[model samples]
Target: MSMADRIKTKLTERFHPLLLEVIDDSHRHHGHAGWQEGGETHFRVRIATRDFDGLSRVAQHRAVMSELDDELKERVHALNIEVIPADKA
Candidate 1:
């Protein structure tokens, strides 16, 4: 599977998000640090989930980060996360 597909699948399985978008931002950051040739580096995630219903922004980010632990350490260079409650968006 592609990196974007893998990320979306993992987030869906883990959080059951109401909405999820995994953006491959590698091209935008070309020549920036950790810009790999394979385009699995920079990412921005917009996810709305009930799992984040009562969580603070930091807590929501932590939860998502934890779920993406392996990817964060290995393939991903940066993750810009937007965690929103399902009802808000």
Candidate 2:
């Protein structure tokens, strides 16, 4: 499966987020370092879930990084994440 699909599936299974958007921004970074020919190196994830409501910003990012550890190490080169609370979404 694609990297985005993997991210969506993993996050959905783990958090049951109220909203999740996995955007592949690799195309925009073409020719930059770690930009592969077929893309899938950079991503932007917008996630809103009650699970993150009480966490600090760093904790929230860590939680997500933990979930996507394999992707980060294996394929994705850059990840920009926006973690929002369900109430705000």
Candidate 3:
């Protein structure tokens, strides 16, 4: 699967998100540091999941970060995540 697809799948499997939106924002960061020819360096993820129901914003982000693990350190240079509870959708 593609990098974006992989990212989406990983998040879905790990968090079972009720809503997930993975946006490739590499084009917006063109010419900036860490920008590459391919559009995989920057991403924005909007996810709503039961796992985030009782978590604070920082905790929600931390959960995602842990799920992303090495992908965040390697392929993903910039990531913006908007995490919310499933009911908030």
Candidate 4:
């Protein structure tokens, strides 16, 4: 599966987010470090879920990063995350 698809699937399974948007920002970073010819190196993930309701920003980012550990280690170079609470979604 594509990196975006994998991110969506993992976040959906783990958080059951009310809203999730995985955007590939690689094209915007073209020619910069970590930018591959075919892209898929940079991403922005916006997710809203009750799971993140009580977590601090750092904790929320850690949780998301933990869920995507393999992808981060193997493929993804930069990951920007926005974790919103379900009520604020």
The best candidate in terms of lDDT:
2
**For candidate 4, lDDT tens digit of each residue in 1-89?**
99999999999999999999999999999999988888899999999999888889999999999999999998799999988778988
Q: Model 3 — which ten-residue stretch has the worst lDDT?
A: 80-89
lDDT of 3 by residue, 1-89 (tens): 66688789999999888899999999999999878898798999999999787788999998888888878787888889987668887
Q: How much lDDT does each candidate structure score?
A: 0.89, 0.95, 0.87, 0.94
Clashes of 1: 0
The C-alpha TM-scores of every prediction are 0.94, 0.97, 0.93, 0.96
lDDT of 2 by residue, 6-84 (tens): 9999999998999999999999999999999899999999999999888999999999999999999999999999998
Question: Candidate 2: where is the Cα deviation over 4 Å?
Answer: none
Better of 1 and 4 by TM-score: 4
Best-to-worst ranking by TM-score: 2, 4, 1, 3
Clashes of 4: 0
Least accurate 10 contiguous residues by lDDT in model 1: 80-89
Clashes of each: 0, 0, 0, 0
TM-score of 4: 0.96
